[model samples]
Target: MIGLDPWSPQAPDDPGLTALLEDARAAAGDPVAALALADRATERLPLPGTGRTAELWRGLAELAAVDLTVARTLEPHLDAVAILAQAADAGYAVPPASGTWGVYAAEGPGARLEARPGDEGRLVLSGRKPWCSLAEHVDSALVTAWVDDERRILVAVDLSHPGVELVDEPWVARGLPRVRSTGLRLTDVPGVPVGDPGWYLTRPGFAWGGLGVAACWLGGAMGLTRRMRTAATEREPDQIGLSLLGKADMALTAAAAVLTEASSAVDAGLVEGEHAWPRCVRVRSVVHDACETVLTAAAHALGPGPLTGEEEHAARVADLQLYLRQHKAERDAALVGQAVADGMPVAWA
Candidate 1:
């Protein structure tokens, strides 16, 4: 894992950024503190496709390497910032430029949050929203609700409003124990619309945001592989250990290569319109496979000793397991295949 840090060569030579990352690593155990750290990160981390896309994603990976939960908390907040900036750029009425934010666009069965007309021509949201992660902690959020039977729009809402209620749902998942992703019950909750109907999903930044999550996944894989490499170095490695190490290195290297290329494509203005969705699917699919490969390899190479004894290692493994589930796996793979079959331009070299 020595030469395998994805951002080592391309990472900016900024001592302050390095120091902030060290601080984030140290404060990984506390979600509240991590939220504050994420707020500070918004000011320093560059937005994707801002000529510093590589640095922005590298910062995310560095955060995940220490703790996936912290990365989970920070990644959404960073994405919310980027989304808001995009909305502002498009002349949408965005919320005040402050506070930690979360993006809650996940739609599920049994819930149908809707937006409708309200006083002063503002929008009001009602019904229930599912999978609102960090709902009780963040100050505000960018949530997607149906504007009509056929259209969905993204709106920013104040989480602390009386109309916003955190539903009591059983969160029994051991992974990411600190970040509770629960349902929100909104009763005529006032919200500021972020963009035109359907703009959120269609925007180019959507793909960039998806790729940012992949960077975190790559980092999580890097974390597990780092431990595997450490154990191999500490003792005389067995044939199986060497084999797993080689397999993991190959997976990580491939994932990193795709991410680097995707970042460049984004900054070079190649990922947009018809290209954005397919590109995101391709990159996420690659990183997700790499994560799964490393997960299996590390488990076999390190055995259950770390799982049973090391708190940090166990948490990292469980957190990454759940985090990677964000990718829809075969369903998403089908999307990539469909895109390819539909004559989407793929620069296969």
Candidate 2:
């Protein structure tokens, strides 16, 4: 496995980092190694500054011909946030604020950024984004906004523009805190358009993005399952033991299978257009159930240790439990019901 610690302060060229990246890239060419590398890299890096890190992991996962939508969603948002953080650390201006969907807005008053025609006959942006991720470190960013009465556009803009305002309130969360998901307010910051209007969320890429979040949750469940095994072994023979171990193992296996199947469906582009909402609802349902099962088993197995201890494992368990609240059982059920009402097929091949 690649040994570079992504959280290290050393430059990207550091020998360890280099080796890790090289190994990851090479493994991308293989099936088993690629999956291993993806799993390991996520475990190691967790929050990477460049989208490339997540992309690499995404690519590795893709090698299995698996659907990667859930993984993709989590990465781009985190990566975008990471870029803003890196930009700030490098002395670039960044906006202050928080929230995943609230990053786009005219939060403050300044030279408003807008896209205009460039010398190459391409759309150019002339606006600033407030509260952007890694805004301090990134001299520019890729932003999406309304261009006219009925058009929206995504563009790359320079953060250093006089019209930009970057508020620097850092984002705080129990998991993936390294993402620096700040907020941004835009002024007329110069930018270049990436694709046509509304393409960002409507494309195959966006579908995969949502799937990525499901994958992250799956990973967390996997982590909990591992912890459960360790805790089970540490249990006294008479204490809550083998039953818990078996339950956790079974839950993990089932969850992993569901995730793999859903990922495969997404990778094959079978989860789009008419099937989009149904597929999403189904995956969300599976993930919600998986999380519940694994977490329950872990809690039962670990007993009061997780609740009372200050150890890293305990903290991880707590975090996972807290996050599961966001994927409410009720909400998922509603989605499934809606999918059925709409007659969208939920089965994946």
Index of the highest-lDDT prediction: 1
Tens-place lDDT per residue, model 2, 1-349, is: 1112211122343354445545644543232333334333443443331333333333323221121222222334444444445445545454431333112433345524456676653555544445453444344456776677566665555566676666566566654233344555555455555556665545444444455555556555665666666665675534556776666566555655665565556546566685575566666567668777777877777778666774445545655555555465787788777777788764552
Clashing pairs counted in every model: 0, 62
Off by over 4 Å in 1: 1-12
lDDT of each: 0.87, 0.50
What ranges in model 2 sit over 4 Å off?
1-74, 77-141, 148-151, 158-163, 168-178, 237-239, 306-310, 321-329
Q: Which 10-residue window of candidate 1 scores lowest in summed lDDT?
A: 1-10
As for model 1, its CA RMSD to the true structure in angstroms is 2.1
Q: Write down the worst ten-residue block by lDDT for model 2.
A: 1-10
lDDT of 2: 0.50
For candidate 2, the TM-score is 0.61
